[model samples]
Target: MKIVIIGAGAMGSLFGGRLAQAGEEVWLLDVWEEHVAAIRAHGLTLVDTAAETSIRLNATTQADAVGQADLVIIFVKAYATQAAARTAAGLLGPATTVLTLQNGLGNAETLAKVLGAERVAVGTTAMGATLLGPGRIKCGGHGPTHIGSFSGGATPRLHDIATIFTRAGIPTVVDNNANALVWGKLIINVGINAITALTGIPNGQVMANAETRELVRLAVAEAEAVARASGISLPAADYFDQVAAVAQATRDNRSSMLQDVTHRRRTEIDAINGAIVAAGQRLGIPTPVNETLTLLVKTLEKTYLV
Candidate 1:
């Protein structure tokens, strides 16, 4: 398949590199000129447990240069979803499938508004990667990726997309309840992200201490209540336990939120914890923890020069 990866950040590079390595026609598209230029010059350098290898692929900042694509996987930041989708219209063909494997909530909805709901899908991934530098990324963790139609149930395209992703070595599954999957991801991020971002600690570090663990649990509890009110049945009943397991699995790795803070970049707090707060208000569920965390993270962002 000819795929255009919009955003081309850490996760984008990893997925595009793996798919390209699997022999798909993959293009990495991003506004980061240094990253795109480096990929053009040296290929995309991927580091994993076994070895570090550079995977050759196409890349460009100008979407018009690529024309139409079979699939457009968006991995852009939550704030830039609309703008990025608007800028990449040249890459969308009539049959082009736009999949959002992005963090936070409402991303698929944003895509649906721009690309038409019929051509868009929602996805959540547990695969983790870190951008070491231009054209270089370290994929340190592997986990399942779930995808489904924006129309709310799994369809044939979900399986087809899952097949392509799995064939590229990204273990994937088709979720009939894509919104629930997204909520599950939001709960996980709500439980872990802001705490890690504020403390400058690895994911597992939160589980090591009672105080930190309690904070994570409370945050998660608030989100779980909101999820239930929204009528989304999460895959796991013990949501806090699931978050802990995820933190344990990716123990040493820093979260995307933490990385954003370290780089003084904006975070998806408004979409993660902030989303929960909005839902809580709309549904009459008080989400004090999520509300506070959202405020705190936004305050921290204010301190940054960027």
Candidate 2:
């Protein structure tokens, strides 16, 4: 399959490199010129728990250079979904499938607006990666990736994409409820992301600390209430325990939000916690904890962005 990864950041590079190694034709599209140049010149280096290997693939800063692809994976930041969708047009043919393994609730919707709804898919992944430098990334760990049609039903196309991903060594599953899958990942992000960014703590330490753990519990409770109000079924009956277990499993890792803060890049505060706050307001549910965390993270952004 001819694949184009939009973003080419940590996760994007890791997936693109793996697909390339699997002998699929892969191209990475990004706005980072130096990173593109580095990949074009030296290939993409992927470091995993097992070993480090470099895989050669096509990469460019321009979308037109990639032409149409069998699959387009949207891995850009949540705030850049619309922009990614705009660029993705060049990568889409009549039969192309656009899958967003992106974090947050509304990314698939944003893409569906620009691309046709029938062409979009929504899902989440547990795979973790860190950008080491231009053309290089460390795969922190691997986990299952779930995908579904944007319209909330599984299709043959969904299964086909899952097959392609699994063949490339990325475990994938097809889900019928897109909203539930997105919300399931959103719930975990809400409980962990903002608090860790605020405290400068790793996932395990954030849950291990008493005050932070309570904050996680309250924020997660509010998000769960909002999810219920929105008529979305959560992945787990006990979300707090689910979140705690995830924290313990990925304990040593710094969250994406924390990584963004430490690197002085903007975090996805608006998408994760802010999405819950917006839903809560529309549904008439109180989400003070999420709202507060949203404000604090935005405030934290201001401190560095200026």
Candidate 3:
């Protein structure tokens, strides 16, 4: 399979490196010149519990250089989905499957608008990764990746992508309920991300403390309520408990939002908690906790340069 990774960030590097190692023709297309240059000079360095391995692959900033990919997996930030979709034009062949494993909501929709709904698919991945530097990433854990068509039901391409991803050591499942998969991940991020970003705490401390745990519960409850109102089929009924379990499982790790705030990079608050708040307003549901979290995170972002 010929694959093009759109963002080439931490998660993107992990999936692309593994797929390339599995003998797929993979190309990483990112605007980060240094990262692209490093991968072109030396191979992409992947670090895991087993060992650090340098995986050789194609990488370029110019999408025209890697024309017509079989699969284009979007790993860009949620806010940058529109831009990424526009940039994806060079890589879209007639049969190209554009899968968004991105965070939060509306990403797949944004892609659908530009690339056509029939070609776009929605999904989520449980694998975690962190960018160490140019051409280097630490994959914290491996987990199942779920994929499905945007309009619902299983497609042959979904199964084909799942097979390729699973064969490359990234276990993937073809789930027909795309809404459930996306909302399931969004609910987790809603609980952990903003709390960790504001408190400068790891996942363990977020749930371990009585006070912060309450905050997480309230925020998650708000998101769950909004999901219910929106008719999104959530994967589990007990979202707070699910979020707590995820935090406990990855106790020591810092959330992606925390990393963003720590580094003064823009966080994905608008897509995560903010998305819930927006939906709440649209559905006439009060999401005070999530709205407050969204406002607080936005305020934090405003102060990044101050």
lDDT of each candidate versus the true structure? 0.89, 0.89, 0.90
The clash numbers for all candidates, in the given order, read: 0, 0, 0
Highest TM-score: give the candidate number. 1
Q: C-alpha displacement of 164 in model 1, angstroms?
A: 1.6
Off by over 4 Å in 2: none
Tens-digit lDDT track for model 2 on 1-306?
899999998889989988998899999999999999999999999886778898999999989788999899999999999999999987789899999988887898899999999999998887777788899888765678899998878899889888888999999999988889999999999999999899988888867878998998999999999999888887789789978977876776778898899899998999999999999999999999999999999999999897
Q: What is the lDDT for 71 in model 3?
A: 95
Return the candidate ranking by lDDT, descending.
3, 1, 2
Show model 3 residue runs off by greater than 4 Å: none
Cα error of candidate 1 at position 267, Å: 1.0
Candidate 2 or 1, higher TM-score:
1
RMSD list, candidates in order: 1.2, 1.3, 1.4
Sort the predicted structures by TM-score, highest score first.
Answer: 1, 2, 3
Say which prediction, candidate 2 or candidate 3, comes out ahead on lDDT. Answer: 3
**Model 3: per-residue Cα lDDT over 91-155, one tens digit each:** 78889989999999999999999999999999988777778899998876456789999988999
TM-score of each: 0.97, 0.96, 0.96
